[model samples]
Target: MVRLRWYRAAPPPDLPVRQVHGFLFAPDGRAFLRVDGARHGLPGGKRELEDADPAATLRRETWEEVTLEIGAPRYLGYQLVVDGGTHRYAQVRMVALITRIHPVAPDLDNGRTYRRLLVDPRRVGDLLGWGRRGSRQAAAARQRAVVEFALPTLDLPPDGEV
Candidate 1:
């Protein structure tokens, strides 16, 4: 089992960053992108050597997974992953607004055909399967983003409360 705790900013540069994920919003700003198969994860994966930064990893992974072009992502948070009795890795989770998207296709890395899910925040935990702790952390970050950033420009209510 693993536990994920959310933070508002990137971890110190000295810490080892393991993976990056994005809570990608649709054009409506109500729903988010989710991979259809697998564990119902967000549209992201591990950091790659060619990636200039974590954001780049998100961009490449999103495209490879769902053919979505993301705008500048807000640094929503990072997750401290603890497994068994030891600390494992740090996962960065960004909230990106989707600008444009093309047809879905098989992921270049794993050759799995990934479909998209534009789902409500209340349903994220059920769909993403981030477990109890990770899902709670993700839901909190989503709430914060909506209140801080998306609220001004959006007409909808904040997603499922904080």
Candidate 2:
């Protein structure tokens, strides 16, 4: 069985970080989601060797994948993925502000341009279908976004136009 335990703290140093993915919020208080075919997921990926840190990894990945830029990232926590009672590795998560959005282009790494969706943070859990865990992370991202980026609480139009 696979288990994901959310933590508000960083994983132990001994645990190798296999991946880094998280919420990337925009100035308008909407979070970014990458849509590849029908799968909806956050905008992040594996750590590259030249990445100075986790935040660096996020910055580089976002640009490489979608040509978007982000501000300083605030570490939220990680989802320690466990399988069959064996600890695998930590997937670090964070919340950051979108600074700039460049023209859409093929990702340098994969050569595929994903459909980027700037959705309401309130709907992220539903979009990702992560249930309770996703809902909690969405809430945390909203709170951190307001504090870290000085973004207002998520306020969408009644007609749901972002």
Candidate 3:
């Protein structure tokens, strides 16, 4: 069995008090990710709890960005990090059951056009390296955490004790 560790840290005074994220997976074993050209990070956006349920938030973000309707998500867990005395991070994980993917009408809400790419979990190390080289620190760490904690739990090869 794989054991996951959840960490937490206090937040900075200025930033919005709460944050969350989702990890959507496709039936083909590819994981759903967003390419945020504006922030140069993975695709995702802020959520105000009142605006949508956590699962809905994940679906909405995925659809708006990638034009795909992700299936019901299975909540994995969360991580909290305090950094630079300015940002507070809460990274949440969810398994997205991707039923289909295709282009749709342009959405003004999403600042940029995002393309969905199916990624092999085993190649995550290479993805992380690319993110790091691109200076996408948050994206790199998030991908690393997924490889470290999530992928292993799924029973893919190149295993390591979690």
Candidate 4:
């Protein structure tokens, strides 16, 4: 089984980072979701050679997957992923306070445009189905967004609509 543990620590220098992804919020405080078939997820992917850093990785992946250009990302935390204790790596989580959603286009990697959704903060964890841990991560990111970016967290419909 795969286990994920969240830490509000900086990205590890020694561990191999498998991916970078996280809570991407717009100026209005709505969270961004990438709709794959029926499952909803946050934007992110593995590091690329051209990416300058983890933040750059998130920016490039977000744009590729959702055709959205995100502003400077705020580092939040990292997830320690253990697959049966045999393998381990880090997945960085961050938050982007501003974005410009462009006209939908196919992802550069897959050539298929994914459906994008802007969601309310309250339902992000439920949508992701990552249990309590993801909920806590979302809460932390929301808190950071509020304190650092002045994003009005949860000012959305009760149904978690944008």
Candidate 2 or 3, higher TM-score? 2
Pairs clashing in candidate 3? Answer: 24-96, 25-96, 34-43
Clashes of 3: 3
Residue 127 error, candidate 2, Å: 0.7
Tens digits of per-residue lDDT for model 1 on 103-123? 867778878776576656667
- The TM-score between candidate 2 and the true structure equals 0.91
RMSD, every candidate, angstroms: 4.5, 2.1, 9.1, 2.0
Write down the worst ten-residue block by lDDT for model 1.
153-162
**Residue by residue across 86-154, what tens digits does model 2's lDDT show?**
768888989988888898889899898798888777788788888898888878877888888887664
lDDT of each candidate versus the true structure = 0.71, 0.83, 0.49, 0.83
The best-first sequence of candidates by lDDT reads 2, 4, 1, 3
lDDT of 1 at 24: 72
80 in model 1: Cα distance from truth in Å? 1.3
- TM, every model: 0.79, 0.91, 0.58, 0.91
Instruction: Score residue 42 of candidate 1 by CA lDDT.
Output: 81
- Candidate 3 segments exceeding 4 Å error: 1-17, 36-42, 86-89, 104-107, 129-162
* Model 4 C-alpha lDDT per residue in residues 1-162, reported as the tens digit of each score: 998899999856888887999798777777778888898888899998888899999988988888888778989999999999889899999998655768888889989778877778777888888899999998888888878778775556333322
* lDDT string, candidate 3, 19-75, tens digits: 455555555445444544432223345675664655766677666666777666655
Q: Model 2, which residues run further than 4 Å from truth?
A: 157-162
